[model samples]
Target: MKLKFLFFAISFLTAIHVFSQNTYVFLGSYNKNKEAESIQVFQLDTLNGKLTKITAAKNVINPSYLTVSPNGKYVYACTETKTPNDGNVSSFEFNPENKSLTFLNKQKSGGENPVYVSVHKSGKWLVNANYTEGSVSVHPLLENGKIDSLAQNFQYSDGSINKERQTRSHVHSAVFSPQFDYLFLPDLGADKIRCYGFDETKKQPLTETKNPFTKTDLEAGPRHFTFHPNQKFGYCIEEMAGAISVYQYENGALQKIQRINTHSDKIKEGFESSDIHISPDGKFLYATNRGKENNIAIFSIDENGLLTNIGYQSTLGKHPRIFALDESGKFLIATNVISGNVIVFKRNQITGLLKKVGKEVKMENVSCVQIKKI
Candidate 1:
């Protein structure tokens, strides 16, 4: 009787461990050909930082970027990119039981080269930034998970100092404030971070804020923006300038606090800094740099919301356009677009450093990586 009771207790604990591991990694890629998989889902092994392929969404065209709905029931992607005026935002219904994604519907993205898509926390609004057209499109999401037609389209007609890349407004990303009350658009070509007031209750949910925009350094082409978990600070990764602009946040307004370089002094030219993200604990921040300098810059966040450079980790691949930290902040996965691979790194929570682990996934032109516990 004693032996049987011990066996039952061990089995119960093992079952709980298996059931608690629910994190998933979603990867988006540029589908150069029809036969290629544009979006793939993998189940992450939390113990070893290994990713196992679960499924892939079918018939997705150039899903270069992806965002999962707040409820984890749906996913949306920027599709048909680089297709002239045919860029689109596609929606998919995610079935966790079967671990599959079903195509729902798509809507015209309102501009060209739709590169980034973000869903509001309320799950009622969706926004996408057009990289080539330098515009933003707002859409209302239906209760059934389909995206409605465009509700509002805001276009920018300004350029910065760089005559080549900053010839016109190139909005790289659209990010929502932690409170979900505001939307921030980082325009790489305009050298400005545009702000908009977001109201979920309105038919047209986005309106220009009183302080409409914050200007960065002349050639600091801001690409991606992320807010700290504390909600008091925001960071923008500037692609052209290869620096991160830190700002103090309050009520939809940002005050520049610091501007730090993402690379060492020796590496100056060809700076293509990309993604930026804060850890779940809000203790550290990471930014990825592409181009000739391919690495993830690490920084420690102080109580006053400023960053101190800690160390840098090599991504072990080329052109890491995007990377994501797991919900637990235990693992980070980076997608190397040019090298056609995805590498996983085990994050040291105490020191906030990363060590590469597990075999890399050989994929072609993967542009984005996002992780969620569903």
Candidate 2:
């Protein structure tokens, strides 16, 4: 009895130590014609902010954007396009023990230049957005953690004020609401946030909502969106106009509350805003600016979900296309697509600011950063 009790105690403590030791980080990049691997895997040291490369998954085409399932058992990637109407989305089964991914299957994204992919809350549907062709598509998530088939494909035909950038439709992101009842597609060309009602029971997952869409500023070029943890408010980063739009969210409706600049007044001309994310505690917000300003705009969220500009932190690289806060909200990783570098920052939990952690990983055309605790 004494030996058995000691053995159980040792196993319990070992499990806890293993759980807190490592985090897996996955990066998606622009690898055209299988020139290089599309996805790179790394094991991040939670203690010293160091990343050790594990492996790379090749032959994935242009997986510019990726998302892991809620269960962390699978990964989904958007295979971007070189030609106009030939994009696809693929799935892989992730093995946590070996830190490897096995190719599952691929399916037509139902659009062109697929840029973003997201899985539904139920893990039963997958959605993607196509930039060049201005379309959105839904796919059924099979029981084996693979995407089975395209369920629905919707295209947008409207254009915004900018003639060159908004000549037609360019869907930038497809995000689901906090409740998972509706899906929002932000179209950069149309300058609107398109809404679709989601039904888990139907073969066709998405339908036009009652309030079909919400218009942004004529040339704001809404690109990425983030929702508050309380589900009462939301924010969108406008790519063209270099601003963030704050909104009060209820059911499927979004009422614009405020519009604020992501960059300061001095840096006015080249505003290529990229991504926005809220902290796990909902006390802070962060957005990335590209073009001439390669920095992250930090903001503090009030009790009412309003934002106050905190400050900015240089990303230490060029064209910070995507940035993400780790699950613990202790580290922030920014991927500079043009510079081929990933910069890591340590978070000040109290003040909601970031400082460089002195760890940078270099890769070719890195576009997406995602961290999962393993």
What TM-score do all the candidates reach, one by one? 0.94, 0.94
Candidate 1 lDDT, 315-338, residue by residue in tens: 988999989998889999999998
Query: What TM-score should be assigned to candidate 1?
Result: 0.94
Model 1: lowest-lDDT 10 consecutive positions: 30-39
**Candidate with the greatest lDDT versus the true structure:** 1
Model 2 misplacement above 4 A: 1-21, 33-35
lDDT of each: 0.92, 0.90
Error of 1 at 48 (Å): 0.8
lDDT of 2 by residue, 1-374 (tens): 99999999999999998766568888998878575878988877766678898877887888899998888888999985545568999998888678688889999998889988998988999999999889999999998998888888988788988989999999999999999999999999999999999988899979777899999998999999989999999899999999999999999999999999999889969879999999999999999999889999999999988889989999999999988888889889999988999988889999998988766999998999888875
| Displacement of the residue 86 alpha carbon in candidate 2, Å | 1.3
Q: Could you tell me which residue pairs clash in candidate 2?
A: none
